[model samples]
Target: MYTKKNYTIKRMLSWTRRYIFMFILLSTIPVVLYEVLDWKWLHLPWLPIGLVGTALAFIIGFKNNASYGRLWEARKIYGGIVNASRLLATMVNDFITNEYALKDRTDAEFFEIKKSMIMRHVAWMTALRHTLRVKKPWETTTNNKSDQEVMKKLHIQEYAFTLEEELKDYLSKEEKQAVLSKTNKQTAVLNLQSKAIKELKLDGLIDDFRHVEFKNMIGELFTLQGKAERIKNFPYPRQFATLNLFFAWIFVALLPFGLMSEFEKIGETLNGSNHTGILFQFISENFVWLTIPFSVVISWIFFTMERIGDVSENPFEGIANDVPITTISRGIEIDIREMIGDDKNEIPKPHPEYEHTQM
Candidate 1:
């Protein structure tokens, strides 16, 4: 996500420049035609255009609100994962003991068990993030060409390594193969985690209460996983998205036509005998053409807002505005491994930022 407090003007311009260029071209067409050809019929009344703009504003507002809700919800879900992961690591360290075991186990064996479970949890995170980053046909980040180019420059997280490569560090060869073979790798990882904990309970390494607590923690992970999957699999309703674009464009198209007449009136008033300065009079006389830039600016606002909503609606898409799942996953891996007493060198560093955004 954009970790910086505010987007720099340079960065904002980089994103919006293409849209601004398109708007300028779109607005210039009618103004050039009207001024050169004297096509008085090209202009539309400002009142009706203002009403359309008002309605379009409301529609865009609704879409942006919905998009923000999705983005914030995804962040909260991952935040829960962060907290639960720490709790899970702490519980694993504390709960497993020889006091409850049917057979006497050494401290080394207990350490190994804690290590295994923690590594498995890391594998689960790897699987979950990889699943979320899988490209959906509807996701703008993957579907848009220019967006893909920008993402390449920023070096998105999922692209840094294949899921299998990352999982190899956390899972045994057989377990990795089993997970890769599954249709839903994340769910499989969680199931393996549950079975492992149950085996611990059966062997009396952990008490019954601890076993239940372990299962409950796994269940919470399941819920969080389901929440993330829901956002990834389900897209915003296409009807609303499609129509919002259409209406916004409609307003943009009619905007210059309406503004041209108002500008021409100003031009006429200035061209009359009331104007004394030649420079001011000439500028005002040519003000009708100024509608192009004015319209371009206004239309740019609407188009950029719509585009922002489109990109924000899918928070797991590995775009600049996405939830930074890869960073979060790596952070959890570091935290959990450290909590379980893994060597400092064995723990991977947290994902770093590029262009002020953590991917």
Candidate 2:
């Protein structure tokens, strides 16, 4: 997600330049036809266009609100994951102990077990993020040329490496193969975690109570993962998205025509006034031409609002404004590794930001 407080005007304009040009073209055509070609009859009524604008405003507002809800929910789910991961690390360190062991292992052996469980949890997170990053049919943000350009500008860690490559560092060859063989790799990893905790219980590293607690924690992680998947799998309603776009464009197309007549009337009034200065008179005589910029600005606002909802609808799509799952996952890994006293050199660093955007 964008780390800065706001996007620079230059970047915003650059991202929407093509659409701005289209808005200008859409605005200019009606003005040219009405004023230059004497097609005065082509102008639309102000009341009808105003009603459309009002309705369009409500539609855009609703869509943006819904999209923001989805984005925030996804972020919250990851926030839960972060907390659960840290808790798991704490539990692994404190719960698994020689106090109840049938056969005690050395401190180094215990540390290795803790490290293995923690690293496997990290691998689970890696798999989850990779699964979310996989493009869905409804996720068309990357398909746009302008959006593709924006994506290239940011450094998305998930795109830089494959899940298999990342898993190598955290999982044993056997465990990695087992997890990778499943269609739902994250689920497989979590199942492995559950089995390990059960074995610890059976082997007396942890008692029945601690084992139950571990199971509950694993269940919570599974719940969080399911929430994230729900948002990723089921998109904002397509009918709403499609109709919103159509209505916004329809209003944009008719706006210039409606403004033409109103501006012309103002110009006529200026020309008829006896006390007006030359500048006012000149402006009045050519006031209808001002419709071009006004129309462009108004249309740009609607288009930009619509675009915001579109991008926000899928927060996992690796767009510049999306939730930074990759960064968050890496952070969880770092925090938990530190919790277990793993060597700093062994723990991977946090993912880097690019152009003030993290993904």
| RMSD values, in order shown | 2.6, 2.5
- Provide the clashing-pair count of each candidate structure: 0, 0
Q: What C-alpha lDDT values do all the predictions have?
A: 0.88, 0.91
Predicted structure with the largest lDDT when compared to the true one = 2
TM-score of each: 0.95, 0.96
lDDT of 1: 0.88
lDDT of 2 by residue, 1-359 (tens): 66444456667788889999999999999999999999989898899999999999999999999999999999899989988988999999999999899999998999999999999999999999999999888885646777788888777778898899999999999999999999999999999999999899989999989999999999999999999999999999999999999999999999999999999998898788885687887788899999999999999889888988888899998988899898888889999999999999988877786443421
How far does residue 58 in candidate 2 sit from its true spot (Å)? 0.3
For candidate 1, the per-residue lDDT at 336 reads 88
